[model samples]
Target: MSLSEKVKERFRRMFSDVFFKRYILGLWMMAEGLVYDMFDEKLHVIKTLPDTFDRIFAGGDYGINNPTAFLLIGQKANDFYVIREYYYDSRKHGRQKTVSKYVEDFQSFIGNDQPENLFLYPSAAALILELREKGIKYVRGADNTVIDGIQLVSNLLSNKGGRLFAG
Candidate 1:
């Protein structure tokens, strides 16, 4: 493939670092898009989820003074579903949870569901340590690639081919 100098310069100016690396260097990169304006429940929601999943995973955000959240996600092929969510707000609840208490709650939240991995926000060091110390397996810090994650989600949700959806 080849491009004129003008076109190359325009590409360089228009793309972000990640996009430039992918497009110009023949490597993977990211794109720009939005999903909030495109959300439609009629298109995205489903009444039932598959009884079995090809993969199961969980994501968690730890908070001492703010809000903590955990999502249990199940996937079958290209489809994803949020099977359950656990959320707690310290301000609304009137008190903070001890690290051990949070861990106990997290374990209970997991219950019989076996998640292949648990991805926690990268900066949630305290929670990560507590979970690890409690003998949790496959716990890893989440990737901090914000733009890449957003673009991928936007494409999956808004793409006309309907390759992916979350319920």
Candidate 2:
């Protein structure tokens, strides 16, 4: 069966459970950094990106003290898949990665996907400006509300209709 068809089949099988009937109605709850917590459906590991999303989007949060983190997300309807990641931490090496270095690694990590899928980063004025100078275009994410963003991600990851596989 096709991937979506397979997903539908799984959903069909799971839908008959009394517990899952309520799961369909529970999508309206709060889920945050608790994304892993909200994953009610079976996990999937996909070797290739499915042709289901309207587009891909990336979101990043960087810090001088903590590590820099980025997530490549695929969006379908209102849900998302974490297709890839770019993470760096200078603390491990007892030194920080320079702005230029971070820019270079970020570019290399993204590789030819630019100007296609939208790239977004949380408001980091200095990092954003520096990255812009390096031919990377990034739009600011909305509000940068930790609770809200986490909840949104959790909701997507936990949705009973959500199908995800990490490969």
Candidate 3:
């Protein structure tokens, strides 16, 4: 079936169940452009990205207490997909995680699959250096313009009929 039909059916199914009324109402609010101005729940499902994507990229945002995130993204044409992530809060570790430790996890996360591009937040410069020192070259700084990036991602998630999932 077509995507629009799928969306309509999905909503209808949700609306049919009284227990899901609140969630469906929220979806209506979003469909009317009244809520989640940057969210695209369609792309948040558990599914795989298309094989047309040729490049894999990884990016990191570092934080000692706050959750530090590393996303592995796949890109095809001008579209993007979030394939996987390594999200952690050092507080959960019971102590602040060192840059070396984060790098070690990052290495294990990527495994033998070296990404074509690696972007790191400025705060992760030490981790970037450590990665390079470990001979895992190919790192760059991510241009993390929140508003602009959100707008772009929202647009892509709406227009591109593809799947992206991360855990």
- lDDT scores in order: 0.80, 0.63, 0.70
**lDDT of each residue in 1-167, candidate 2, tens digit only:** 34577776777677533334445434444543333543544354455676666776666778777888877777676555677888888788688877777778777776755524334454577777778787676555447566886665555555545544444
- Badly placed stretches (over 4 Å) of model 2 are 1-35, 39-44, 51-53, 115-123, 160-166
All candidates: TM-score: 0.72, 0.65, 0.68
In model 2, what lDDT does residue 150 have? 67
In the range 44-143, model 1's lDDT, one tens digit per residue, is 6777778998999999888999899998988877766778889999999899999899889989998999899999987988888989999996789999
Clashing residue pair totals per candidate (backbone < 3 A): 0, 7, 0
* Candidate 3 segments whose C-alpha is farther than 4 A from its true place: 1-43, 160-167
- Using lDDT as the yardstick, the better of models 1 and 3 is 1
lDDT tens digits, residues 52-167, model 3? 56888898888877888988887776656777778898677777888888889989988866799888876677888998998888888878787886666656655655434442
Clashing pairs in 1: none
Q: Which is the winner by TM-score between candidate 1 and candidate 3?
A: 1
* TM-score between candidate 2 and the true structure: 0.65
